[model samples]
Target chain A: MPELRQEPITKNWVIIATERSKRPSDFSVKKEKRKGGTCPFCKGNEGKTPPEIMAYREKGTKPDTPGWWVRVVPNLFPALAKTGAGETHEQNFYLTKPGAGAHEVLIESPEHDASLETHSQQHVREIFHAWRDRYQALINEEPIQYIQIFKNEGSIAGASLEHPHSQLIATPLIPPVVDEELKGAQEHYQEHGNCIYCEMIKHELGVGRRIVAKNDHFLAFCPFASRFPFETWIIPQQHQAGFDSINDQQLHSLSIIVQEVTQKIRGSLNQPPYNMVLHSAPKGHSHAADYHWHLEILPRLTIVAGFEWGTGIIINPTPPESAAEYLREVNTNLVEEKERLSWQQVH
Target chain B: MPELRQEPITKNWVIIATERSKRPSDFSVKKEKRKGGTCPFCKGNEGKTPPEIMAYREKGTKPDTPGWWVRVVPNLFPALAKTGAGETHEQNFYLTKPGAGAHEVLIESPEHDASLETHSQQHVREIFHAWRDRYQALINEEPIQYIQIFKNEGSIAGASLEHPHSQLIATPLIPPVVDEELKGAQEHYQEHGNCIYCEMIKHELGVGRRIVAKNDHFLAFCPFASRFPFETWIIPQQHQAGFDSINDQQLHSLSIIVQEVTQKIRGSLNQPPYNMVLHSAPKGHSHAADYHWHLEILPRLTIVAGFEWGTGIIINPTPPESAAEYLREVNTNLVEEKERLSWQQVH
Candidate 1:
């Protein structure tokens, strides 16, 4: 019979369907659908999307016009919106809250093919600054309790629009994932009197096996328990709890590492779809000392199967050390040229 | 830097790679790589896999032969094995454990085209019996702490072989997901004097909006807080915490509901790739009254994006009520015939 299985730590329940099962062949992987049409995110098409909430444009450009390297607009079809600060309602054993939140899309460039790997480092730094700036602005909104800044790079990573962009979702409630991490961090702080993320960085450096790349202010490495193949993380070497806490020099360092790791992945895996998310301390909440903010870049190279979904335990085939070693050896200059050549051919 | 972020609920740590960022167009959906030429799971190819651990065969049929309707064997390339129970080695901030456990494959049928939707109910029941029988046996092994039985239907769902089969992964530690659920159930029982799952089932039945299908001894419903679109759960009417606690009549009823629900899904989504997992109480463990085991069927129609991975909050575009209502109206018999005609054309 189908039964409810509760996850031990998170206390989340998943229903396991036991009765009818399909053969391996019965399930077919459909080709990813790529919508081809006039680019809505491109320059001169600002009218196709919601009007710009914030844009870093040329010295006298209009609000919704061209010449903007970084543009922030509300999601046309947002999962959560600012219009209704709906409260959560309860119905017996089930619990639900209004999805009163803000959703914005950050267009990285005016051109369709301007990827992070192909973009100039200076421009990428502007994108990072834009992310932190929006984060700071959104966190102060009364309805928003959590700000999620994430980028989906391909259809596999859940991007519907073929645009080089990042998304920010400002939710009213603390996201379950973040809440858990906060709790974990707090507990670790109480027990050890140290930031767990900071401790992790210290220990990993001592081990050195999982380190992929490093800059003066930032470090890139593969995690000890990587759930996916070639999963990489980038974090500021100096402990900081919020993305907005970053300074100009830190932003530059962050941008370089981001570009470096991205290029490494493209060169090594020959360009795979990936998802990147910046995780920081919850806004309007204290526990800044306990939590150390970081960015997580997950490459969509493998499928999360039944075992993973059922047990909440991943069975990764590749070891983290091997993945890190392969990425570290990738030639950035060669990869950049190759990416540009590919973009030239496509665009 | 790359660091392990432990999910609070399940305590399952994920490696978050943050440095790399790719464009939406950089990711390419890989074509499902089906290794052609050999049919390893066929009746005559029984020698291809490890020797049978158990099998349901006709009278006088010998082991390692073609007469078995359902067969069980050890995984050739197991993620965790019985040979070495590797103890988790701890680094300063990282935790590592030996993946010492059992991995088994249950071939549902001899034919590649055999699916729960296509196979007779009697045969599927036999497969269920095999699962329980094996579960009972594996739990007694010294290294086995928990058992997980899951089936990946399509390539997207993580099945490499095109055979009709299910996998059994017996782990040395209680998986974080299962552990979290057990704790939740225990706490719920202590406070309310009831099983959380039973309470949930009662509540869901009272509000029939999310219900997909139900039989005499079991109920099938899409949860109010479904993480995925058309994410359905099946539960027994009575509170049975352990799967092995099921008697003959319960098994028969369970098989019927399973078949009905699977048919409904195929009809509703035109046979989208999916993952079905059987979640039962850990064997040789106590706390039976507090926990109730169920099955979860998650359809791969939507992508779990960056927000999902980052915040553990799902943004399902389709609500449970609409999904259940659509599923309830599908003509399963017509869909079955249509499926048969398509199979005939393909094979």
Candidate 2:
């Protein structure tokens, strides 16, 4: 049955419904396929795109060569530009500023079909490092105030290209939605003298029904108020206000947990199209003692209808407890075992 | 040129881009030709739907008959139900309650081809009255705490049916997004000792940049920080917390303004798909001193990609000033003028 779960901090309600549960095979994965033509992001087509801003390649390999493991490039049709003296002007009751911001793409792997869940832990770790480096570089820009890092896996989730990659955009202002979260966390801290996310972690750990997977350093669980069906969040066990603060050991552990959670979702829901976003404090903001950085995963399962648009309340068809139970039942081999089996099968 | 605008209260930014401006002739309105046999909303198919909850008919006409000017009925596949005893249960860390609420549909016209923009002012008034009656009835129910009234005009805007109509869904909880607006407005009021919306109206009136249309009683403007292109909002000049409190004369004036705005958009933008929502105070909330009731109109002119979903900031392509300028240029004809033209053309 569908169950309503409330967010402890924002008090938003999400419905999880087990009765309307769908298995992995039931999910339709054939996304709208873009016709391949003069596609710039494809391998051996580097000259078609803007010159690479950064890339990871073998020592002695040239910039846009075929040997690169990962690459970063500016978006050709960027919503915000990289170069402009940030300025704001007012006209009558309205105010406007130049669309000054950075939009960059992080290609995860050389292979066109490789996904994060399918990558080795070391490969995933390298991707994490690239993300951190980009975040740091963007934050260092004088005009940038906020940086957003996100991935749209399939067309339904808004990925225009079929390549497995993520994007990062740095904006000149702190978005209101993030600001509201900061304010809520600040107010909660003032009242309780503790981080609101920490309280939620404690309560969730004690209850254990919404948990999907966990390790010593990271925990993955279905949020109390999931905005979408089978939505999940991964948070550090310790209070950390910034994504850059994640240590190598924690990154390794998080990679394992993330892999496990995604594998479970893939095995259970047939690799449904989804979007994942990493949320951190804005650049130059004082370290928020009451805020914790986390990753939010939303599966594009149902279309948002009139009611949700009008009221900003989501009606989730699947409840979290049932989702957790279903996820827990999926059989996943350890990384080593899977690697060994794959190697043996290949040989 | 595209310009960014910000909402003073929420501080969200929207981009207004007129470079990609389209005329009405450019819009493709090939109606979704769904076969009539499978459509449950077709006339003479009354038995397929729930019994008519209410209808406006001639003195001796029967329910669900041809003589009715408008109709109200229960949604066949309702997101929320009418008959359920409220129950809240705890499952580990999550809490859930029955989806007990009201979901009703207001059929706008019987001809099926007629839209709200084509309706007479009196016809629109009757629809508003129906909404008022339904609002009054649903709020008095045991579990409903908030009521939302909205219209979705096209499939891209989340309308499943091609028919012209609106929906009202009363919920037991206040949505988080709505709460954020309320909190922001309340905070502003406490700090400035004034209603934030009234202050905004005064500022907009003074500045005159974003104003689309205004009268002695109502003011329509493109919000500084619109979330979408050509987005517009209508607010009462007086401080009213609830839409149900609208008097008949006020309703008439509102109908005139709404009609004029809709006509302008239809003429200016080639009948762009849009969503219009009426935001009012929650049903039983006593502290509405800081709340302001308004109608938000969002045109479905752009796709919200990953950046918007992750950061909650919208990039509008058209500036509000340019949008208002375009709207102001349109020749607005009141209902009487339209009637006179039709009669003259017929003769």
Candidate 3:
């Protein structure tokens, strides 16, 4: 029998059906590795992809040319397309729009071999600038309410191609997961009249148990109720809701912190597959003072199974305190080591 | 830079961070297998486990003895413990309660190798009785608002032990995901004055594209917007909110359908790992005319990469229609084949 369990505060019901139970040993991870050969994102194969939506080229280099450091293109098979006018139609109990949205890919490097942690601080800064530019451009488009920018590292993390790239998809809707965060933040603000993220940062800075890395403007730490092992978030110290509003100096500092954290993660976890997401306020919303923008990093250390899917309560194996301690002690010198290696390869 | 994008209808935000991007080829699947050892859940190992909270025994067999066909014991390292009073405390912007709840293991069979699909119908029925029994017991306890019943099949699905068992974790707070579903269903009911699930059933029955199995009491189909590949839901045909209210006649039919679906899935996907959750109306909620009970089956065919984690929008490779069709065509003769093999082994 499947029992209907309600969460007291949230008042959500999750059905736990034990009659259809399974053994733990039966879940096998898919280990298939699709080696890259006929790659579309390769440098010389620029003509194979959709016309460059955006590209950072060296001065004197033509568009879609080999001399580009990074290139952005419309996805060949976008989940949400840009063709249709954004309109939602409801049919009885279900609601769906014509999946009208923009899906673009950001080519991180021409080499396709170097990971972000291995990239020079300058290169990382360029990537940051590209992101800001794209975010601004996509949000200004008609009918786009939100823009999602994310990178899937390693196939286990869900990358289809072997090339180093990230994707941006503009959507007509705000997903349910994001709504929870917004509501939580809004409630926190309503009670305290302050940004929840700012409060979290202030507390983390004071407590110092979950802190991973910090600079003058940004602070990174494992969340108190981290949903996964080694899950970390990087939040701006100031009450900012939009990532595009980041100034050049803050972007530079963010680039440094991002590089350092990624390097430490790579060093500590032996380059484990992971995911990084940037959370900013929605476009068209008057500055949501209650919300502060941040980046959340979830390492693909464990797969979410029955309990999490059924109950929405995650069981993280590594406690946040231990994860923070491990990350804090990571040797920052490895960033220089990785940079040296990349430079040698480039030369 | 990764941008946080929000879903409009659900009002949820996801972070898309490309600065910490990884190469596509690097996202290879990791097939980590658990090392087998002396089994703790095996028969005659009663001393190694906590005292049995519940069990089904033969007439003269003792509580912690070898004669029991099934057993229930407290999880040693529970995510939510039973000891705490679960006092809620607020620290500035954060709110948390002690991780207090019931975590118990439902040992499926005395024989370690028996899968549910291979279990006798009587055994499956017994499991249902046990589920209902435990759920009622937990709900009676104060501050325990929800009870989550789930089974993690295989190591990649976060199963630490290589045993044939399921788990039940009762919690104080309602999970956010469940809350979204309840709100969505409730809102639909308010607008249409009908159960959203019943409407879905009507639509699915009308359009047989996603139907996997159907019976007099239940209907199983792949959701139109499935979050994972080969994901299916077994929903009641009638407007029933609580699963515990299921009659014996319904249980017999449900067991057959559940067993058949499991067999078909096993045959179709080469015994792929899956998670099954029963979604029902919360405890104490009198038969909600607007809600319907159901079971969700998520097959771990693909890893949820960064895009899904960030956006909450799943990109399914195989369409639901194709998956349902494939599952429908599977041969159920495997049941007889297994029986014959077992008979031969006995001879």
Candidate 4:
């Protein structure tokens, strides 16, 4: 029989469709070919993009130049502009707000095709540092209430370009999903006198069924109520409420775990499209003690249809235990060599 | 500049990404080929499916016979099974329940290629009748708390079979999205002493820019804060809480309006993949007077990526007003003939 499992924090129910349970090999996604063009994010092509806001470059190199490994640029066609007054207006029952926010892109590498799974541990750490720098800068903006950091890989996961990059959007209002998390955590804190996520981490560690990986600072695991196949989360083992609070040592550990989990996912699923999101407390949030920050990796393996859209109830065909088992068995080094050969043959 | 519009009832903010504004013609999807095999929902192949639950057929025809115009059958691989305790189980802090509920497929037409936009008005009415009958039957079940009626057209929208069909899933608990709508509506009612949907209808009619099509009993319009590009809603003019309460005359008008709006969308967007969902009051709910039943049509033109997943804030490239304008200009009769000619050339 299938099971309806409730997400501990959000209170959303997900139906684990065991009747049509899918193994890792059952989901096959074709690799998207890069579009033929001059890559704007390539090292020498930095002039093609807007002026850089920040970059981790050689000491002698100038901004928007060739020496940067990770560069931050404003989105040319931003969903929200930075020039608005950020005022909310009411028209009878309806409400409108000026789309006043910052939308910046963090080019993760100078190489056109370098992914987090393929990058060196130090390179990934530099990316995290750049992300932290940008997050701190955006949080200081007067009107910004929330900053969202996320990465979309491959075309179907909403990567318009094949170049590896992540985005940070600072908004005037806290998004609804984050708000729900905050509210749920606050409620749990009020009732139980502890963070719900901290309790969840303890449960997962005790059960030992959903853990994909763990280090001194971070633990990676598939959530109990996984909404997607191989939906993994990397969270701080300690009670940390913000991504900006990470120390250099913690960042190194996070990078290692993130890369390990991503490599396993790519190895097992044939380089499927995925989205990685950093969920942190809202700016100046009151429930910082109750909330726990985490990074969610959602593999875009299934099409979200009418049922999911209408009801917010996902039908995940793969159980988290099965997903974690597959991940545990994957040899990332061997898979990396196999992937290189396959790519060469395809090209 | 982009604009942030808040959905009236749910209070979800949607960014109208005017910077990347897309017109109706900007989105194009290739038509999918039918797999070379028997279609189970076709008139002669009713036996291929699980036994019929209910169907509109000729009086003399047997239950799983060829005479049926519309058929309802159990989903072969149901997300939720009919036999289970449906008892909530607590494992420490986590909660789970048996997926004990009904999942049924409502075959809209016996003809393999028929669609809501292409079907005759009378045929559409019969489909509505079958949906209503199944919904009423499922609502009376002891464990059922909500019945969701939805249709997914084309492969990308999650249609596995080529045959036109809708699905009804009666679940033991009310879904979260429905719960949010209920709570929002109840809050609005408590504050204003009127239904939020009724107020929305008045606002749209008064503005006159968002209306797509309307009749004496029904109105079809793009919502102010549509999450999707060509998202549209069809609602009754008068307040109606439960979809089961719709009368014959109201059903007839709804059929006309639904068909017209769907035809317009098909004509304007060249038959895009879409999902249509019917939202109604939950079973034995107290806020019946505040809730209003409606159908939402979401065109699947864009990929939902990291930002949307993380934030629950949708970035819609096409504004609802622009979508309404394009829909209003479409000549459905002429487009229908053009479609037929194109189909002949291809097939």
Q: RMSD, each candidate, Å?
A: 9.0, 5.6, 8.2, 5.7
Best by lDDT: 4
Question: Of the pair 1 and 3, which is ahead by TM-score?
Answer: 1
Query: Model 2 over residues A116-203: C-alpha lDDT tens digits?
Result: 8889888888888788889887886867888889888877677868787889978888876677678878888999899988888888
Work out the iRMS of candidate 2: 3.4
Chain B TM-score list for all models: 0.84, 0.88, 0.85, 0.94
TM-score of each: 0.87, 0.84, 0.85, 0.95
Residue B279 in model 3: lDDT: 74
DockQ for the candidates, in order: 0.25, 0.38, 0.25, 0.77
- Please rank every candidate by DockQ, starting with the best: 4, 2, 1, 3
Candidates ranked by TM-score: 4, 1, 3, 2
Question: What are the per-residue Cα lDDT tens digits for candidate 1 across A195-273?
Answer: 8788888877777777887777877888776766778989887788888788999998888889989988865674778
Q: Lowest-lDDT window of 10 residues in candidate 4 chain A?
A: A338-347
A173: Cα error in model 1, Å: 1.5
Q: How close to the true structure is residue A87 of candidate 4, measured as C-alpha lDDT?
A: 84
Binned by DockQ into CAPRI classes (incorrect, acceptable, medium, high), candidate 1 is acceptable
Taking candidate 4, what TM-score does its chain B reach relative to the real chain B?
0.94
lDDT of 3 by residue, B1-347 (tens): 22333322233433322333323222234454544357778888877898999999898888888998888999876667676665666644345566667789998887777777788978877777677788778875867877778777666666777677888988776665556667777887898888777887888887777788776687878776665566788887888877767888788767767777888875556576778787766666537776677788887766777667665766555556666776766667634333211212211
Residue range B30-137, candidate 2, lDDT tens digits: 345433454455566556668889988788877876677778898765767776666777755446687777778888776566777888889988888888888877
Candidate 4 achieves a global lDDT of 0.87
Evaluated at residue B286, the lDDT of candidate 3 is: 33
